[model samples]
Target: MTHADTPAVQGGPELAQERRLVTEIPGPRSRELAARKDAAVTRAVGTMLPVYTVAAGGGVVVDVDGNSLIDLGSGIAVTTVGNANPCVSAAVAEQAAAFTHTCFMITPYDGYVRVAEELARLTPGQHEKRSALFNSGAEAVENAVKIARAHTKRQAVVAFDHAYHGRTNLTMALTAKNMPYKHGFGPFAAEVYRAPMSYPFRDAGVDGPAAARRAIDVIEKQVGATNLAAVVIEPIQGEGGFVEPAPGFLPALLDWCRANDVVFIADEVQTGFARTGDMFACDHEGVVPDLIVTAKGIAGGLPLAAVTGRAEIMDAPHVGGLGGTYGGNPIACAAALAVIETIETDGLVDRARAIGKTMLDRLTALQADDPRVGDVRGRGAMVAVELVQAGTTEPDAALTARIAAAAHAQGLVVLTCGTWGNVLRFLPPLTIPDHLLAEAFDLLAQIIKES
Candidate 1:
């Protein structure tokens, strides 16, 4: 049978897997909607591509302008089961028809319990675990911090450089970016410390173990383990450009956390599910976090996030100390359950590894010929290229933006990110067709070369 016949195939054979542009990038209808959006929507809200989407399945997004573009962003890595996944959609419809939200904090539902059980089973470590659901990655992250502080009786939380936790007040403090995510937005939460991350691309000769030492030194001298409650990080840093930590860095950091009683929280919001080839990125290093903040791919595009970890740590938060009115809404829980099933039954974990191999091979080859391509790094479907001034590691944000814009114009949706904003990240849904990925990469390579 063809790949499309497998459970791993996105949407189905009926969905168009090709990119077709009948008009300019933003056709008249999308332009009209854009004008409407300018009038009705807040200016602060931004879009990567201005085209208005109508339907998306498999690897293609159909826009209102009748143009179909290859979706490489996966709505910022949320639709791992693919947009409108059949299983998830069916579950959501069934749950929504029965009941939407009774508030798990008020009248708990079985779906929430089921999702929590699944989370406990899937997250790293075979220990007894517990999970709390929330509405966003930021909520899960904030809740994780609360749980850590409650357990350790410490107030300071350490986040790494080049990390993008979220936009909430606490998560914004956790995040490292400034221009768009943090500029003028805070008076951020205090007692949040920044530590050096293992950016092998920028930090010369710093391997994983050595990088861990550097971060540990900073936390010891600057924050002190006594005052630190947690060291939160994205195993494969997401918005900060799919920056995968050095091999030994995470395990070493976890060891230090255990020794000093600091909670090691892995923010796998973007890398969890099957996006990183492994169910969770922490699985790569056999590092089990004290708490893992998960979202994005959790509910197959629905708004859901979770913090799953050891039972003792998760139970530290007092009753009613960790829930929200809409946390673990019934419908979202149903969706999450379906998404987990899809990942398992479809063998998306292996699919992610295959996609990663293809992406790494293609990007690595491109890097061999282009000095401006400073680095090609990532795991599974979470991959990226860091653009730099030729022969130097200096960021080329302008060039990156130009290439992204060119790709968009040519009916391919690509996203750029990084601390210096020179990284082009590719987060295609695990369900994306191989040919679609190859097509998008070809367009991207051409744009990069032309630029």
Candidate 2:
């Protein structure tokens, strides 16, 4: 069936799923809302586009200005199943009407257990697994570290360069970039070490296993395996320019972790669910992580995250350990269950791979024509275009910003990432129409030409 015939485009949530510009990009209503936001909300929280979304579904975000922009970011890869997905929406409504928050630790419900069961069945590997839910990716990641430390009786952790875990105190420490995420957030948690990552574009001389050896040498020499509790990595670095590690990098790292008894934590927060072509990015290399941190696209658009790992490792924490009041809220858990259903029933994993092919083919063509386009990388819907100066590897962050801004003005919701801020990341929802996808790229190509 064509995109126009899909349920999302066929009028769920009254969204047209087509890019429409009734007014200028931000328009007047969005500006008014932005003014109110500036006055009421903290300036610390930054918004990518000041358009002020009113409704979003499929591949289009309808702003208060009566403009619909094609979504390429997916709220930084959160709304994979699409914003206001019917299944997730209905499930959330039903659960909300039943009862909202009871605090899982206090009055546990079936929804939480159901989500855990589904996670065990879905995540990579058939080995006995357990799950703990949380409100955000950061919370899930932090708890994963806690569980790893508890299980291994070690304190030190290693995070890769250009990685972005979250904005919490512990996650900030885990994050590599210094400007926005960690600029003023000083005196971060200690015992967190940095390691080299395999960047195929930059480190062309080295392959995957060789790169793993580089990071392993640093970890063993500096942090020491005995002192390390976990080695945290984004299987495909999301904020780190969607950097996919070299071929054998992850498998080799998993081997080292297995040998050293170090908990290998895959932060699949951005790459989890059906965002990647595989059920999980770890599946690409058949590298099963000891602990997997998941969020972003977990519950459609609802706030829910989880740390799933081996039953033994997950059970190491004490009786009163792991969980929060809002963690695994009934409504969120219900949404998560519905999301899993949508992913399976809708066959979104294959859809994600298809979307990847469309994007990669288009981007690869653009790279071939433009020398400024340094690299086109990522798997599935999680893809990125790294910008660089012609004839050199030096990042062209300014040019990237101009391209994103131009795309935004033309009703294309593009996002920028990377440690150097020179990457344009595309994370279109799986439900996005092929026409809209093509248009988004065409617009991007035109904007690049103009720039």
Candidate 3:
């Protein structure tokens, strides 16, 4: 059986797994939808690509205009198991048929307990762990911070530069980007601090350990260890250009957290669940955090998130301290369980590593041949290339946008991210066929050349 026929991509509306352009990128049908959306939806909601999706499975998203575009964005790294994964869909259907919700917080069910059990079993380290489920990454992250403060009896929380935590008030403070996420919103949650992150491409001379010291020094001078409750970071920065910290950076930071009794929180919302070649990005460096915030790829294309951590730290909160009305809904829990089973059974961690190799190999080659390709970095299916002026490190965001637009027009769905808006990121679903990835890169290379 082909890879696409497996649980990863099965149980979806099937279409030809090839890029086809029957209409312009945003055809008449999509334009009609866009008009309606503009009228009904808030202007604050923005879209990178305006094509309206009808069905998506196995490497392609079919548009309402009959355009089958190669999907390299994976809905911003949320569909790692592929859209409408059979395992997840089947679980959801069964659970929905049985009962949708009784509100997990009010009347707990076995599915919720089972999902927590799976998280305890799968997350790093064998230490006794506990999990609290939520409906979004923002909720999980906010809860982690609350747990940390409750355990450590501190008010200050430090997050790294170039971080993208979420959109809630507290998470907005945790996030670093200002213009889009924090522009008009002000007076964010108090006592949230920002620390410098290790960007290998930008900070050339600094190594991992030194970068850690630099950040720790800032933390000491600004938010003293006594007042700091947690230090939150992404093992691989997601919207901040898929920036992977230099070797030893995470371990050094983790060591400092341990020494200072700070709860280390890994916001693996974008890099978890085999998207980064390993089950979790922290696993690559062997730096197990005290608490890990997970979402995005947690429940295949479902709105679910989890904060899994050491039992002691997680249990510090009062029984009624952590919960939402819809937290750990039975349907979502069932989907999460199925997602875990599929990840284990399909050996998707290895598959992610293989996908990373393919992407990195192709991207680095483009970098070598073209001066516009400033840097290429990432792991597993999450890869990116920063665009720059031909000879300097100056960000060329215009060139990046042009290239991405070109790719979109030519039947490929790509995404651009980074603080400077100069990084092109690729997050193809693992269920995508090898040939589609190859074709996407080839088209990207051509677009870059033409641009």
CA lDDT scores, all candidates in order: 0.91, 0.91, 0.91
Write model 1 residue lDDT over 1-451, tens digit each, in one string. Answer: 2223222333443578899999999888788778878899999998779997777898998887678899999999999989988899899999999998788877788998999999999999999999999999999999999999999999999999999999999999999999799999879999999999998888888999999999999999998989999999999998888888888999999999999989999999999998989999999989999899999999998999999999999999888898999888899999999999999999999999999999999999999999999999999999999999999998999999999999999998889989899999998998898999999888888888899
lDDT digits (tens) for residues 211-248 of candidate 2: 99999999999999999999999999988889999999
* Model 1 root mean square deviation, Cα atoms: 4.7
TM-score of each: 0.97, 0.97, 0.97
In terms of lDDT, the poorest run of 10 residues in model 3 is 1-10
Error of 3 at 45 (Å): 0.9
Residue 434 in model 1: lDDT = 90
Evaluated at residue 320, the lDDT of candidate 2 is 82
Off by over 4 Å in 3: 1-13
Off by over 4 Å in 2: 1-14
